[model samples]
Target chain A: MTRDAALLLPSTEPVTLIDPDGHPVPHVGHDLPDPQALVRAYAALISARRFNDQANALVRQGRLAVYPSSHGQEACQIACVQVLDDGDWLFPTYRDSAAIVARGVDPVQALTLLRGDWHSGYDPHATKVAPQATPLATHLLHAVGVAHAARLRGEPTVVMAVCGDGATSEGDFHEALNFAAVFRTPVVFFIQNNEYAISVPLARQTAAPSLAHKGIGYGVPGERVDGNDVAALLKVLGAAVARARAGEGPQLIEAHTYRVQAHTNADDPGRYRSADEVTPWLARDPIMRLETYLRGRGLLDDQDVRGYAEQAEQAAGRMRAGLGEETSADYRDLFTHVYAEPTPQLREQQALVADELSREEER
Target chain B: MSAEKLTMATALNRAMRDAMHADPTVVVFGEDVGPLGGVFRVTDGLTAEFGEQRCFDTPLAESGILGMAIGMAMNGMRPVVEMQFDAFAYPAFEQLVSHAAKMRNRTRGRVEVPLVIRVPYAGGIGGVEHHCDSSEAYYAHTPGLHVIAPSDPADAYGLLRKAIESADPVVFLEPKKLYFSRSEADLTAPVPPIGRAVVRRPGTDATLIAYGPAVPVALEAAEAAAQEGRSLQVVDLRSIVPFDDETVCAAVRSTGRAVVVAEAAGFASVSSEVVARVTERCFHSLHAPIRRVTGFDIPYPPPKLEHVHLPSVDRILDAVDELQWEYA
Candidate 1:
């Protein structure tokens, strides 16, 4: 049996196309995305960042229960989702609201779970995006399953499952990766290593050289990318998607980034981390770097910048307006949708609840 | 339709084959299910009939198997996944409880997980730990999961087909002990409906409600009870989660006495549920308090002590005798 040479000597450096300063950097064998695509990705990143800010504001206003802001990781979320085809599926995690919004899920619907509502707020079938899983790494196996089934049915479909660095420590993560490799499922796993899994940091999660290296053990090729670099993320994730669609099995793309905000509206980052540790990451801000690159390449001017800003503002306003409407959940919804046909016991329980509700109405 | 004698294993295989032949989306998969025809051989000749794409072996991971089945089901494929053994299903409990059970509801009916998780459960063959476990209680406790267990060949074939055809997720528990038990059945006859019970034997003295592995033991007890001049009615509860309480209550009301039997532990089991339901519905029937003939509240013991641990015909008879005692 011939062993992969790269598996024996894995690359330590991440695949990077541009530096933190937005200057072109040399990388082996990877080309930049076309100017139009880069510009579009940049627009998505800005919009996602604005959406994150609005969602945080809504949480403060008591309109939302919580919001896990994907502030610094906008480039990773936007670029990874931008590479998928209309028919392909995207499986995202709780903190992946930016990715969900980037994939055409309405901002209000994407935050519905965090809003403590019944069911996932949007139809996953309509958007080709699975419900944003709050349980870490669980959706990975679902992604692999869908991709494997698609392959079995001779469908030219690939699945992208996005998870956090902390999620890689979950057992489902290992099972998903191993199953994908063994079954040769057409899946691409994108890990945004954003430093913390709530209060826990990456160091506490794994002792491996990197999360990407974990894929090598599962017979999956691993690639690391600058998560803050939109062009690099698009390039690496796009290639991985292409490889999966071509039936080359699965690959793991570890995007190195950091979480810029607290875990959520309820969390206090100051309790665990100091501001000094966060200062250096501010220089590598994804939106600023992308704007710099676009301005330098003459693709963006003052008018274009103002236009993009107006679009972001309008999107945020739409989210605010959507949240402003009052939507009441039906109490009977709890009994329905649990099964195709509710069991006899369920029917009895539903009647009991209905009676109680009626009694309360009379009262 | 001509009648032929077939074992429960062969009946289940035929059920899978028929379902696969009927629907192009029906896929069967699990560890050892494809090539070895499963360790129980219940899936024998399936992979040979259907190609590997339809019937295949999965990696030896229960969570991955079930998770993939859920995905396939959501994507318009009817997937029937097998858990290699009863206790082996524990690894996939998270997937079943969190995703498989909650998907259709979580998606608000935009997608339905038309998946069937077949598990060979309950002990009588004297297997070691982790091999023989009656874990139906766990799945039954979870909402959105339809838990069904069949005893005879006819119900086995019929229930397996209904489960695969159902739009909801079903935990189809096959009694491992009944796998080799043969019965004469017309293969082409109309199968029974899902989530209903059938009367194996009718009488008036007492009612014996049993399912899966315990059904045969209950029938044997009923025959033994007949010799003692006590006519016992045997009710085979086909499904546990959507239990046929109406049939159970009707039998209990007529007989005025009831005994629930199962190989699973008595605590929080299907037996306890039946006893509770009978007591609630048939209180004025006035014979005696319900007695549960079930396995002891302990782990499945070693083979040597399995007979003592499991509810036998004599134990069921003893419970039936207790049903004659007057209660306050």
Candidate 2:
């Protein structure tokens, strides 16, 4: 049932496995992930940061319509994705492109929605990931549904639904948690508490002691972790995944991190926050902290760090090249896939558009 | 096939039974749908026959229920979800409009949400406020959804089965008032394909286009008009989204006059669409402007004033009288 009272009690301090200076801190009741897994996580974190930077650059170059950068929250994204099996599904929000990429999606494919594509770039069924939902908290319900159906069919699949702190305030969020708790679905809700929801700070979002505590009201276990600490995130998210797979019901995780960049290229963070407020979060960057820990463990040398950087650079170059290729838009896509079989009305509309296009070409 | 006199409610129940028996992936869920067998008893005995896994009750959250149905549908399951009342479905509008309806197109055919949302709609059973709203137009205006409503037992059984078997999401609106109406029909009859209209009565004088709850009223008006020596044809536009424009326009073109009938509000209603399409296609053939007999444009009034607010037999007759019969 519920965890021990000590574990359930709300704490202002996040559950962390590594301090800001890159030293490993012992967790009382949790076991750190293997050193090899931690090292692999460090690489993925580096890759995510590089990918975010490339996407942001594309927006400035007029290649991408916009981008939501997970600049400082890579650990939350990569660590949570690392623990999922091939059969498990990941329901990601628009801001969770890093998680989507970490789940084996191509960088260009994951940015399809932000690129103004008609639909998701990749096949969700093939990748075992749902489309990146733009509307807030709606994917949580879908995640619960998929997990519930999997349980009904006796499948050993779990679901990881990722959302932001602001999304927790939506009615769908409340409904999702309540339904998941009632049905005991194998779902883990990962909320990245990145301090501000497009400039609205957490203090204005809710009066609750912590975002994770919201799960307790629905009877689901809640956990908090320093999002920038890859080791702690891996430990907490891995445990949550295990609990769900064991049919122990859903769990909520609040990853305490900061959004180092603006919400999007179109957003101006200076409108609501000052430089002083952002300076502190930059000091606790997830990548630098993990690099320090790996160096301390003698698991990473200067050459190894350079190799990871090169790998990230190569991936970013490939992404940039892929996005630079232009593809013409098919106007017929407007009518296609509205239904499995296009209705007579849609067929008529398609013909009208075709006629208009042909007339324009003749003119 | 054996034939028996069955009520619309029973026909719907048998349809669900057949769908679940034929397809293991088909699941039925909603509030009070399990042990209670639904408030109107339409889902009676389903849980007992199919087991709780296939048939179960859900919490009173409409958004959650529909949201889960979308997820289930996306993942190799056919989920038939019930919205206890028509107005109660408002809470799930975001999920329906933003996700379930758009999933197929949004995923570029890679994903299909084969979901059937069943809502008991319209007035006449003395229900008040949220229980009696006619909100079909709201769904019809949405681009990626298929909207259908049935007026009789046979269509209720057949259309509901077709909806569950469809590859896209369908908004299946059941006429709550006609749930208990009885008809002699064979449950195993070959159902008609969706998105086609059926001419219930054939006549050359004029066309009365109606669907759902207003079909019976339109038929009554046709009967009274026949006695008055004004022959009237009755057309039931069963599927509203992919409306049967050919059938409707053909009838209206021949008669040179038309009257569209519905229980929903008159402004921007399905009836309005029907009238506009007919007028566009049959401008030269029409001897008179097409008229519409629909509920007044206002919130569904209290039960006592429902008869006045809703389109009645008199209203249909009045619409028919407004047509230029002398010119015809």
Q: TM-score (0 to 1) of chain B, per candidate? A: 0.98, 0.99
The residue-level lDDT of candidate 1 at B158 comes to 87
DockQ score, prediction 1: 0.76
lDDT of each: 0.89, 0.91
Write down the lDDT that model 1 would get: 0.89
Best by TM-score: 2
Residue A235 lDDT in candidate 2: 86
Best by lDDT: 2
Clashes within 3 Å, all models in order? 0, 0
DockQ values for all predictions?
Answer: 0.76, 0.84
Interface RMSD, prediction 1:
1.1
lDDT of 2 by residue, B20-93 (tens): 99999999999999989999998999999999999999888999999999999888899999999999999999
RMSD of each candidate?
1.5, 1.2
